[model samples]
Target: MGTTGGLADDRALLGRTSTAERVADILRTRIAEGYFPPGTRLSEENIGGALGVSRNTLREAFRLLTHERLLVHELNRGVFVRVLTVDDVVDLYRTRRLVECAVVHGLGGPPFALDGLAGAVAEGERHARDGDWKGVSTANIHFHSELVALAGSERTDELMRGVLAELRLAFHVVDDPRALHEPYLARNREILDALRAGERTKSEQLLADYLDDSRTQLVEAYARRVADDGETPH
Candidate 1:
């Protein structure tokens, strides 16, 4: 992400928070949006100066993200975005399956808001129409964010935001973005359609299958990269 103007933009995104909190919020969003891709070093001077924060305050922010598993600290190489391993990928999907599938499974017995999920589906369709695969990828993040929101708990939403942020780290390594994201647009539609039609069982099954297929695809892609680098994929 551009080290400049992030604080102001992120303040708007975060509204009112402590200085260190604002810094972490901005950095977290930047990392999630693929602004700070995996392994990109965060320049303390550049970021601290750009945000007009003291080094100590900025360091505190960095520490927050590091704790979130979004940033990694090296002895002398400074802080960089965390590069997820295959084990990380598997765990991420496991979390997704537990959270999102539960939301789908719980749909029938109670009433909840579907606006977030529908809105994200529409956003994805809109972006896909314009051949904006990256835009679609961003929309896909929101789609899952919306799915988690269906659980109707702010705590779950908060937990999932971090989960998706880590998932994006895996997404960043895709050799072909369209190949990675395009095939899923219709699948999302099917899941949404099943939910809309009140087929809770079908919806849950679709999501479970979606999670399994996606996990496999991402693991294969990541493994290929690691193998190319002469390191065994985890």
Candidate 2:
């Protein structure tokens, strides 16, 4: 038997650096796409079948996600999606403020990539007018992502994506999604407008207020949910 297998080509065909990392990426996408909600138990058997990956590979991916704080493993039970607490929200927003505000201050010069910010703002408004709060939330994520991208730092963008994913879980706790997200659309636009006008100090202040309002909303929403969960019998 004579065969020259193109293992490297095969790897490229899989579209990943490794099977486990690929699986992890897919799972992350599922989380981002809202396919897996917070607190949902991720059955290895079901996920393995759906993804057509072996148990070992799936578990490896699970390990990666758990490390990323997107999933958590129970003592005896299996892995489940992480539900960010109010404290988690607080810490997450704290990180967001530090990073996002600094990025605004560190802007190199004019011709800033503020258009993405504007586009995200417009997207949110359009979604809100159409009464699609989830759409607005998605746009909000894009808005912040674009804000981080303004720094032109891949590491920062990667870090912020994970933070935003964690933040999304907190949003799931909101009772009125529309009410929670509606007020922020205009706020985002204002930030973009300030940046476009080259008002760094004003933009920075707007961003601080933006993060403060969001943190307060998420904290309150999470607190209410926690109280409700306490009342519900296990």
Candidate 3:
């Protein structure tokens, strides 16, 4: 089994108390962080040993992520991270527009809590300056996750977490991180600015447009990549 790089260092995160849900959260974050890219075979031995968990516990974690569409189990072959298709990409954006736009549209009056959104925008700008488009991508995801947090509903937060994690699987197939993530930095800022200025409707409109443009960009690029690789979308 091939090693999942950087997973060993994450063992300390579980510390003395480790449960299947906790383990699954760690693995989910690692997936979103690009430590385990799409379709990489997950070695139960290595990951179980790294996290100092029993095989049963590890398998339970794997099962949970599998149900979330983040992993796929193959008969006799073991499990691997999922590689999303163009259809999956389109469906994800549709869900995003529904949830994220609604979140913005449901917000209260001005003087809203814009700290988290502001911070995410800054984080993406910093990554862009450092030429870390991958970091920028992560920050961009953070921005949306924060956007969902505006709803202040734990259930919505949990749902978006899974959706965004699945979305990251599609993001992994992008050949150029800058082209995929760069244009959004300024757009994210624009949305944040409108929100800060008490422009709720404006912010929601910008967000809707942002999600639309991103969906188009990712779907087209993903279709091209899949075609170039001679694989049909499943």
Candidate 4:
């Protein structure tokens, strides 16, 4: 399919607010949803037409995502979704550990607005039951996004939005979504349950351990895939 296939519906989102940032958001979500996998060249003409935005606005959006490390503009070449390196995988997890663990540790008490976390856990279970591992992976990302929301900081949420989207680029390298996402679903529930019970310390520990296991799993899988493709690890 072309880059802009079936993007007509997305035009409605920009009907009222057609800022470059909004366009960047729509593109970012598409990238995270695997609509535009790593290395796929983005067609500015097609995308701008489909989104009903001007070339200048689209370029600005591209620049924004490039800054976020989700897209890259090559000299004399078009912008493309970035293919993450093994080192990128490792660094992403390192950042996740620092940010996510800190968010969990900073929670003062129970009654942390956990509805979002619970919803994500349930969403993952639903997708798992339907044999949709990719859906499970997406929900797993959502679970963490909601977990970070516990901190109630808009800045942190915005930062993780980009980080998690970049992490999805790494996830695209994994051939087996079930293996990558299944184990973590239960672990997500464990963390949420602990939080609901006001066991902030236990939740933090579980989250720390969970991030460690996930980091290990992704790094190994991503490294092997990069090697198979003959790309040097950065």
What C-alpha lDDT do the candidate models reach, one value each? 0.85, 0.86, 0.91, 0.90
For model 4, how does the per-residue alpha-carbon lDDT over 121-173 read when each residue is reduced to its tens digit?
A: 99999999999999999899999999999899999999898789999999987
Over the stretch 1-234, how does candidate 2's per-residue lDDT look in tens digits?
A: 237566655865364338889899999878876789788889999999998988888888999999889999988988988877677889999999999999999997776777788889889999988999989989999999999999999999999988998888778766678878888888999989888988888999999999999888778877897688762211
Candidate 1 stretches with Cα past 4 Å from truth are 1-17, 110-112, 229-234
Best by lDDT, which number? 3
Q: Tens digit of lDDT per residue, candidate 1, span 118-222?
A: 888889889989998888998998999998888778998999988998899888877677888888889988988877777788888998999899999989998
Candidate 3 residue lDDT tens string, 140-164: 9999999999889999999998899
lDDT of 2 at 142: 98
Which sections of candidate 2 miss by over 4 Å?
1-17, 231-234
Going through the candidates in the order shown, the clash numbers are 1, 0, 0, 0
* Candidate 3, residue 36: lDDT: 95
Judged by whole-model lDDT over C-alpha atoms, candidate 1 comes out at 0.85
Q: How close is candidate 1 to the true structure, as a TM-score?
A: 0.88
